[model samples]
Target: MRTPHVVVVMGVAGTGKTTIGPLLAGRLGVPYAEGDDFHPQANIDKMAAGIPLGDEDRRPWLDAIGAWAHGRAGLGGVVSSSALKRAYRDRLRAAAPGVVFVHLTGDRELIEDRMAQRQGHFMPTALLDSQFATLQPLEADERGVAVDVSGSPEQIAARAAAALDGLDATAPDAIAPDTTAQAGPSPL
Candidate 1:
């Protein structure tokens, strides 16, 4: 078998990172690490106040997430992170040299609607516009795959897993293995 890769499920909030990350991890048979859990308290507080996080506010959190992902790479574990900007993703790559990113794509209206309907989350819809504005779409050299988020959670997870595993993107026969049921908390 090919070696399992550390996959970063990246996108703006409400693009299903939290939901899909765990399922992907379950299929890959690796630990799920939520990138949000690594955010600094101040960054979380800033988002809670409806302020978009600037690069200054994000640096430490990115470093932490990158370091964590690096550790996972060393262990052959799977990890999920937002990694919205190209620069941020670059930094993460520098930290975890061989990580693969799965960029989740969706319409702004759709993402905003999902964010509005989500519960128990500190990220406010007020920051959605800023996030959309700041998002740097995956560049050609990023070694990433972009999956549209208009499908069911299972579909999204399955696509990400297949891409990382080097299977056909739409291989219906290659169903994702269930990892969440056996793994602990998920991170994206």
Candidate 2:
């Protein structure tokens, strides 16, 4: 919404984080960062092998994304990550102040169907269950908008853009938070 508000599009696998992230960023005229780009080769290998990432495995990855967000402060960009836990979101927020989230949500059947239709992604449908288990929905206090994935990508992106711009009538709460004052990243 704001010029420097880092928007993290988060959700379990198959909720269209990758698909919508770029669209949202483009609509906002900001850079788009793929969360997968931050993962180490080892992590990718593990995921490709159908192994779920533990918190320890995610620490460095989260930090890298956080640091990127920190560097982009005041320039605003969109990034996509599962961000499946509250701690992970908190860490990201601490690293990049004024960060907001766009949570993609839907029924398991819809999501699993979507994942099954994908090809060449390191993350397989087999791990979707784990991803959902790990996902902690955005709390009411969190600065975010929960967009259901039932709509077309363009529809979702437009709604997200409008939400960020305080133009979304359906969900008026997506307005940007007051972020003139911000704190620096926390220690890793």
Candidate 3:
């Protein structure tokens, strides 16, 4: 059997984190969480009003997501977040040790086009520049894979799974010993 891995599907808005996260979790046979749901209503309202969130506004939200990830440390699960900065990723890592990140990346023009077409999302397309500016790609030492958002979600998830092939749980496969559920909160 193998220990379950916590996967964070991270990227800027419109990178399809929401769409791809659940599919990735399903592929991994784990639960899925929407990181956006972690944000307080105030944050949502701010974004809905076309206001970019300052770092202070994001701290509690980041902490909440980190705590959620921490709760799933030993079990496999997927969560989506716009983890756009190194400090943000560090905060998540601090809370959930060994959490692997799946960074969804793509060309600016392509992402903006997708954002322009999206509806009912709190994040405004106008803030796309700030997202790009804040983004810091995963470091070489990070346990993660950088996947291009150019492909379909299925393809992207497949690639991410493949990228994590050598990362099988140190303990045992989830199916072994009938321990499908490891240690973590129920899927959100």
Best by TM-score: 2
Quantify how close model 1 is to the true structure by its C-alpha RMSD in Å.
Answer: 8.2
> Better model by lDDT, 1 or 3?
3
lDDT of 3 by residue, 1-188 (tens): 14567889999899999998998888788889999999999999998888888888888888898888889877778899888887777777767766788999999999999999998888889989888888899987666788898988799878777766655543235422112223332221
C-alpha lDDT of all candidate models, in order = 0.76, 0.84, 0.80
Candidate number with the higher lDDT (1 or 2): 2
Identify the candidate with maximal lDDT.
Answer: 2
Residue pairs clashing in model 1 are 26-179, 26-180, 33-187, 34-187, 34-188
User: Across residues 59-114, which tens digit of lDDT does each residue of candidate 2 receive?
Assistant: 89998998888788778899999998987888888777568889999999999999
**What is the Å distance of residue 186 in model 3 from its true position?**
27
Give the runs in model 2 whose Cα sits over 4 Å from its true position.
Answer: 167-188
Which regions of candidate 3 fall more than 4 Å away from where they truly are? 166-188
TM-score, cand. 2:
0.88
TM-score of 3: 0.86
